[model samples]
Target: MLDLHNHTTRCKHATGTMSEYVDTALSQGVSVYGFACHAPMDYDTGFRMSFDELQDYFHDIETLQERYSGRCTIRKGLEVDYLPKHLDSRVLDADVDYLIGSVHFLDDWGFDNPQFISEYMRQDMSQCWQRYLHAIRDMAKSGLFQIVGHFDLLKIFNNPPDDSVHEAITQTLESIKSAGMALEINSAGLRKPIGEIYPSKQILRKAFALGIPITFGSDAHAVQQVGFGRESAQRLAKEVGYTKMLDFHNRSPIVCRIP
Candidate 1:
């Protein structure tokens, strides 16, 4: 099992240190690990690892990399917010071994502020989805972030979205396949408002038929969730006909078997 989207104390909301996360992953018997802290965005982002503290973060991960060399392979990653206006240039591209492009904030008004979710809840669900999918398109076209994180997270705030909305989502994901970007099966949703995997079974099945690649991430804020339910996700991936996930090093994909 491998998780590429996890946060540390550096990211205001998360609490685990790099080593602690690695240690937990070790106990869980996961052979591959990734440290994907939240990256900067155009808006007033709330959760971020200070640019000043970046060296220490890298040093810590590097130290673990050396110490756990024979135990588990570690990958440096970033979960970049897919801000449409700034999508052409993002930190996920300049740094990090891998990127998980995510659409967390859809508008220019509310950022990581508390009012964001509340305001999002009040907005029209269809309009919300429109912006979300547009952001996804930008992320896929960016040529960065091989992994597409939570492709349909808008549904989390409002479940049982209308049929027209589902059709719109499918259209966007089909473009994801044509763009050659991989999909992330985020397991964190099981604990969130949606209470299921992001990009539900229907989306996964559609990706299967469209020939999009599949990847897995726990998006674990705490070490306890690192690579959570990875076995089950792998089973689902196989059931959907994805035998392997992509690993991009030096900006190239190296196929890794899921089973």
Candidate 2:
């Protein structure tokens, strides 16, 4: 199985070494594991590692890649926030197996963060979803990423988006398809207040009908969290009629049959 979106201590908030995470993945029988630590950006300095730490991050992943060569496949990746003006080429052009583009902010406000969740009650919920999906559309159009991380993460706090945002979701998924990007079925949402997988069953059904390729990630932040909810994620994918899932090697998707 493949679990491609995980973080390390470099992300500031996540705990554990890269090796510890791999050990957990191995214990869970994951054949292909990846570390997509939060990419450094000037906007969120507190949560992500500084630009200078990029070297060490790469070195650590490379070390794990060699150390786990035969036992399990290790992929190097970066989870980049799709902030238009703040995105740097150093990260966009980083040499890694893949990049997971995500939208965690609407302007300066991190809509997903509980600290500013009250803002949701203040604004038009549909407008907020539209703005977030528009960012996803632009991120896909940029051709800078291989996977879309946590689609519908705006609902992390259980702030449901109204049907008014239907067209936006359709357009965003179309953009992802046009970009040849795969959507990650992130299980982390199950651990969050939303208590559902990323993209939701509704969105996943739409993506399936649109022929967008699928991938899986636990979005693990701690060692014990590695490969967490993997079985449920696989079950969800199958329920949505997905028989194969995408992994990556050198930023190119490698399709594997779901077992």
Candidate 3:
């Protein structure tokens, strides 16, 4: 199995050391694993790493890669938020295996944060949904990331917009296809109130029809969560007619059979 999205203590909300995560992946029989801790933003969010810690984060992963060389493949990566003006170009220029671009905030309201749930409730659901989708499309067209993380994370509260949101979703998928970026089938949503994977079956089917390349990400924040829900992710891909999943090395893709 392969999982490309994971977090560490550097991302304040997550637990476990880089070694612990690698050990857990080995136990889970994961052949390829990527450490993609939330990248640091220009300002403090309290959930991600600090800008100064980025070098340490990269070095730690590099050390683990050598330590676990024969046991499993470990790729260095980051889950970078798509904040246009605040984006840290270092993340894009850094020597890493891949980058997972995600939309976690709309303007200043972070829709995914638990503390901001009430703030999300106050906004017009339709407007928020449309804005979120447009942000994702912009992230895809930016050409700075190799993977799109959790395409439908706005449904974290189970308040997904109506079918009218399809146009925006289609536009985002088309942008990702044009940018040659892969859509991540994130399994973390299962642990949230949403109780389903990101991008839903509806979106997944459309992405398949659009010939968008797919990748799997557990979005693990802890050791036990590594490779969690991988089987379900694979089943969803198979049902959508996907025979393979894309893996990355230095931002280049390698096709592997969906297992």
Give candidates' CA RMSD values in order.
2.4, 0.9, 1.0
lDDT (tens digit, per residue) of candidate 3 on 1-259: 8899999998898877778888888887888999899998885469899889999999898888899898899999999999898897787788989999999989988888888788964788888889999998899888999999999999999977588888888888999999999999999998999989987999999999999999989898887888788888889999989998899999999999887
Question: In candidate 2, how many clashes are counted?
Answer: 0
List, residue by residue over 99-201, the lDDT tens digit for candidate 2.
9999999999988777787787778878889899999999999999999999999889887668888888999999999999999999999898989889889
For residues 201-254, what per-residue lDDT tens digits would candidate 1 score against the true structure? 888998888888877788888878787777777777877778888766654567
Candidate 3: residue 250 lDDT (0-100): 91
Q: How does each model score on TM-score?
A: 0.89, 0.98, 0.97
- Model 2 per-residue lDDT at 62: 90
Error of 2 at 222 (Å): 1.0
Q: Give candidate 1's error at residue 123 in angstroms.
A: 1.5
Once fitted onto the true fold, the runs of candidate 2 whose alpha carbons sit more than 4 angstroms away are none
Report the poorest 10 consecutive residues by lDDT, candidate 3: 116-125
> How do the candidates rank by TM-score, highest first?
2, 3, 1
Rank order (by lDDT, best first): 2, 3, 1
